[model samples]
Target: MRKIKELGEFGLIHKLSSQINFRASDSILGIGDDCAAYPVKSGKFEVISTDALVEDIHFKLSTIKPETLGRKALSVSLSDIAAMGGTPKRIMVTLGIPKKISVSFLEKLYSGFNEICNHFKVELCGGDTVSSPKCFFINVAVIGEAKRIFSRKGAKPGDLVFVTGTLGDSSLGLKLLAKNKTRGKDHKFLTTKHMDPTPRVKEAEILGRSKIDITSMIDISDGLVQDLHHICESSNVGAQIYEDRLPLSPELIRTCKRSSIPPLPLVLNGGEDYELLFTLPADGVKNLIRQFLKAKVLVTQIGKILKPGGISMKMKNGTLKVLPESEGFNHF
Candidate 1:
């Protein structure tokens, strides 16, 4: 057998999925979907999503504490719920820890999880703990409720696309952390961004309740270009993002200047932002902007959905160019 690295993450998933023979059932829409579907007796639908965080791959133990790890594990699952325009109600977390990890470290991790759950009103249901052979791994499954669910396939042409908050801070933070470690320069904002990320749960709730007729929604876990490409591919539509409209944080700009790197690429292609990227009807753009403004999050109008095709970026010089296809954060 070849090494997992040779196959890459998505390739390995495809390889494994090809080997499995799934039995057909009324409840199971398994394998490729973002969240698995199962029948619920109640009138309302129930959703379950899980995400795993492993040491070294997702985070470095030297920089990220156990508590942050636990909180982030829960947040990533919650982001999936947000993508579906659902409210998270409950979560179950399973931990794989090395034997050398202390009880106190685990307690702090649970405390962080509890804090986030309390903030979101999500209950910690149940989970299992196991011993890892080497490093730590945390997985969280979130259960959510929705009256009308949002899917990636719902977008249409002429829909206006928007994103919550600024982009590239997280990626710039990672760069700053690496630079600081190597050059002994202290950059607090960048370091904080790498350690802690805010999930746009409130924004998701507001957008869900506004009844603004959103066509589709997604969380930017991967780079903006890649994540938007998901919606484009699923909905069978193309997109044209205005390069000038991309929102870059001041911190990101300053850091980019300091590092002598162009901020535009980082803003466009960086991942782990955890911000909401969604599309709404062209008619409802004003109302949506007002709603988000009241929530104090600046929503940037980056682009519009087009007829089914490839993605293009309108450069500052007013030229359109096709966006190259690329994968983001491939885990093997």
Candidate 2:
């Protein structure tokens, strides 16, 4: 008999997912991709995904406000829809409320939810609320529609890997918040990034509508290297990312310099960036840049797909170092 820790997060997921033998024909996608897609009469696939945020693990009550938490709770799940090249339509929130929570907190939380929903034009459907013994948590389910769907299984050796926005800022912000150093002017932007992450819904929509052939996609919720590994695993291809090609915000670089820590670790291994990590044909790079530029979204080419079997990083010294799958956060 094997324990869960021995199997690891992906192993456990594979184990459980393999046992689900009752998938229907209408359910074209399930378990493996960011969201499960079902074809509908509207000439689109209805994609659905859910994510849970727990106290201490996902956030600290002392660090984040209830409203910030609420927006983030939904944002995380929305990223999944974006990964599937979908637009968010409706959302449902399930709360594990502790006795220590107040009505004001819940009200502020809903206000945050309403603000985002208005911007995205998403409907606020009903959900369940339950009392908890101690720690509070939130589970958000988002339903979306995609005219053209993307999955993790499409990357080829010639695909060029791209990532949206800057990496490492959010994770570094979380680190700074833990030490209560999030008050200064320099820390403000990074800290806010850690709290309020924007799901790349519009950007994904642009890609889906564009002529570019986006081979594979996943959001950077679990770190760049870790999430990119998912693409490699699914597509049966390898990747080689250049350290210098990784996009980093000035604030993240300065913060790393000030703290005397390396930025690469945070950029490659830290989680909760919520940006899009995707792959497309090398020929489509020009068009991808043009489309995202008009939208004012930054998409950086950090790597390339290979025919081999492992993920590697090209150092500044021009050495290729293999990155272990254990680089990212393990939920277990």
Candidate 3:
């Protein structure tokens, strides 16, 4: 038998999905894309996405506030709906709490969930609370609707690739928090990023509504290269990203310089940025960029798609290096 570590998260998902023989016609999309979509009414589709955060693996109570944890737990799942170009409407939360946790903590956590849901105008209908054997865990599921949907399979060879906001900040932030360092002026920004990531709901909505044809879309929950690999595998194409073209925030650069860690690896392989990575036709790039600029949204064109199915990065000195397919977080 193959070990789960070797299979990785995606491989494990594929393995399990292979065994499921029951799928209805209404299950229009299942187990593959960011969310599962089902037709609800004429010209509209209902999409649902779920994500879970564990105690030690996802966050530590000592380092992170309970309220922030609650918000982040929901934001990550909302990002899935955003990736599918859907607007969040409703959410259900399930919590596994340790017996020792206080009522005050639960109240503060629920407050955090309310804050985020209110900001997005989403409803927190209901959920279940259970006693955990050891550590606390949270699972959030978001239901959304979209007139038009974006998926991973639409990119063509000549399409251009783009990413919203910056990459690697959240990953670097998590590193700083783990070490308990609190020195640099930018450290707070980094820590906040890791502790409270904003889902790209509005940005995804703009792209979905834009006239420029977005060929494919996905949020960068995993690293950029790894997430882009999903687009490539689904679209049956390849990608080549330029190292120089990648957008890195000033805070991330300064923090990296202080830590003496090369930033490229983090940008490529680090996870939990919650930014959107997408592709569109080369001809539409100019208009799309213009549209985003008008909306005061920052989107950078980093690369282009290829006919071949692989992932590579072009170094500053002009050497192309192949990125390993499995170079991202494995949740197994």
TM-score of each: 0.84, 0.87, 0.87
Using lDDT as the measure, name the better of candidate 1 and candidate 2: 2
TM-score of 2: 0.87
Tens-digit lDDT string for candidate 3 (261-301):
89998899998999999999988988887888889989999
lDDT of 1 by residue, 113-156 (tens): 86677677776655656768899888888888876677788889
Among all windows of 10 consecutive residues in model 1, the one with the lowest summed lDDT is 18-27
**Residue lDDT tens for model 2, 1-332:** 56544555455445433432334345555555555555565788889898999999999998888888878888888899999999987776677877677656766677678667777777555455676789999998888899999999899998899999999988899889988897676699999888989999999999999989998999988899899999999999999999999999999988899989799999999988999999998889889999989999899999999996899999999998999888898898
What is the Cα-based TM-score of model 3? 0.87
Query: How accurate locally, in lDDT, is each candidate?
Result: 0.76, 0.84, 0.84
